[model samples]
Target: MGIATVNPATGETLKIFEPLSAEEIEVKLALGEATFKQYRKISLEQRSQWLKAAADILERDQRKFGEIMTLEMGKPIKSAIAEVNKCALVCRYYADHAADFLKDVPVTTDGSRSFIRYQPMGIILAVMPWNYPFWQVFRFAAPALMAGNVGILKHASNVPQSALAIEAILTEAGFPAGAFQTLLIGASQVESIMKDDRVKAATLTGSEPAGASLAATAGKQIKKTVLELGGSDPFIVLESADIEAAATTAVTARLLNNGQSCIAAKRFILVESVADRFEQLLVEKFQALKVGDPMLEDTDIGPLATPSMLLEISQQVQETVTKGGKILTGGQVISDRPGNFYPPTILTDIPVDSPGYSDEFFGPVALLFRVKDIDEAIELANSTIFGLGASGWTNDPAQQERLIEEIEAGCVFINGMVKSDPRLPFGGIKRSGYGRELSIQGMQEFLNVKTVWIK
Candidate 1:
């Protein structure tokens, strides 16, 4: 089957491209391997220059590319523009920092001049999601290329133009032909590509099932894999938290990427004393949001990336209501809309067995849970299998310390929302998927940290 770009806003198939044939796949694999052999030999300065050039190209035409992202995936135009700008920031960040990050580390050993050198392997396969189309690919490509490895991207099929746009940027920025490439094949084709000996490792950012399938396949081959999967991140608000600030941030955190992001706050666990006020503030904010076309500059919430996402989220909300939950604000699909549009929704008093209690809401739906105290809040927050990220709001030092120590998430924010930054290592624990992304740690994930000893 061929890949196509279907606009999430109108449910229209805008473009289609045939999947790569066996011969084409072989050509790319050979090119990836051959390119890595030559790329790894290139100077850090040269790679850095190209990365910067890519960043420059992105900055110059971010709006145009941002529109493409909005058209394909239904991200609000403003947020899409911000996403494209952020990609450029990541490119520049890796360009400036990769050398220092990969420099040799001196180690004490029996050998006089003992050190550890970081070297690139070969081709890396990145199976990325379409939520933040440009951001996700650039984050991987910038570091992978800067570290002297080639990347072959199997981006989510929904955003085929985005997949190709990335390759074009790298090409126009003066990178070698095969340094970075996008494969237009479907998910079924990913395993065969990964099984190839030329592809050294794989990194995925998608559903748990997809990550598991890819990881298992890679495991059988003993090829390393980095998986960033689902997250049911908790936004915990304690009695001492500034309820206003916490609730305000919660709106953005929960509805980020039209509530399609893996890291978006899904479960809001609130202490009893502050729950009512926080709930009131959250509802007010949700009601104030403008839900409309992704291309609209003023729209705060846009359509879900696909119609299936709309159906799934609607069913998730219905299940919770049936299992003893109350819809405080919005919880219905927009029937008149042509696109996959679901209004901002809030579900309160969700029972323990309700789907809202455990399942991740992949749209603009928020699950609110009331807890007796910080202890109950922490317990409820840690109950999920996903330990990706958590945001705790509290002014009490002891409570803050407890939140930081007790939250099962890989990353915790005391007062701010959980977000990915180039300076910080980002990833999750447990079922949220393994390994890390961003920072020096992310750059080192696919590198060979070889120990060098001198007599």
Candidate 2:
């Protein structure tokens, strides 16, 4: 099947695109290789200038770009706008910091002048997801481009328009022709791209299966790969937490991006002393969210990005309930809605052995588990196979310190919500995938760390 954009809110096909033929794929790959040969020779100052221009274009056309994202992926209008702005921020960040980050470092090598130099690899294949269409691609593109690596994007099939728009943005920003290209192809086409000799390394921000497939392919080719895969992040609330604040933040954390984010809090582990009150507040908070048309400014939650997502989430919730879980609030899919809308669901007493305990619910559903103490909280939080991000709510300094030290995640937010920032390195440990993104570390991911030794 070719790429198609169906408005998730209305279940209408807004646009469709035919996949490129084998000839077209070869032509683009040749162009990308040709572009990288010249593009990598450009000065850092020149690349920075283009990146800054891209940021300017994003800020200037945020409204238009945001609408495209919303129309294609069913994100709320406000969130889509914010996503565009965030992409701009990342562009600006890499533009400003890339030179410093890639600077050569002198090393003490046996009384001679030796240094390590960071240089770009060849064309990189970026297999990106559609949950945060614009943000995800830009996060990869900004850093890779700044590192002097050309990119070939294989964006999720559902967001073809966003994928094309990104290529346009790069061209408008004065990037050399073929510096960045979008491949409108399906998952089946990725292996061929990976096998291309010009494609040096690959990075993926998607599901576990996708990550595994790409890693396996790249592994056989001996090409380096970075995988940012799925997460079932935990939100732990201690007895010392500011209950009101924790309760409010928990709702937003679990439901951001309509709960499609891999780092979005999926499991809630509340200390038993405060479990009763916290659960009460959580129910109240989730029940008050306004779910409707994503185009509306006031909408707090929107439909799942696709019908499959809705069905999967619904099945997970139903399975959890059947396995002795309790639904405290909304559970059924919304009625009289043309879109893939499921009610904000809260499940308590989910058995630790149930599938919901390990699965990342890629929608607005939160599982609650009452813990006896801080030790139990941490145990429950770390029980998942994914370790992308975690949040702990507590007022005690010692408790906060302990949780931060022990939480097995790429990021830990104490008494606050977890989020990815352009300034901070964002990536997960364990099954959540490896390598950092968006900071000085992110800029170095696609670079060649050449070590020079003087005789």
Top TM-score: which candidate number?
Answer: 1
Q: Candidate 1 vs. truth: CA RMSD?
A: 0.8
Mind giving the per-residue lDDT tens digits that candidate 1 earns over 26-62? 9999988888888999999999999999989998998
RMSD of 2: 1.0
- Model 1 TM-score, 2 decimals: 0.99
The model with the greatest lDDT is 1
lDDT score, candidate 1? 0.92
Each candidate: what lDDT?
A: 0.92, 0.91
Off by over 4 Å in 1: none
Write the residue-wise lDDT of candidate 2 on 19-59 in tens digits.
98889999999999999989999998999999999999999
Return the lDDT, model 2, position 35.
Answer: 92
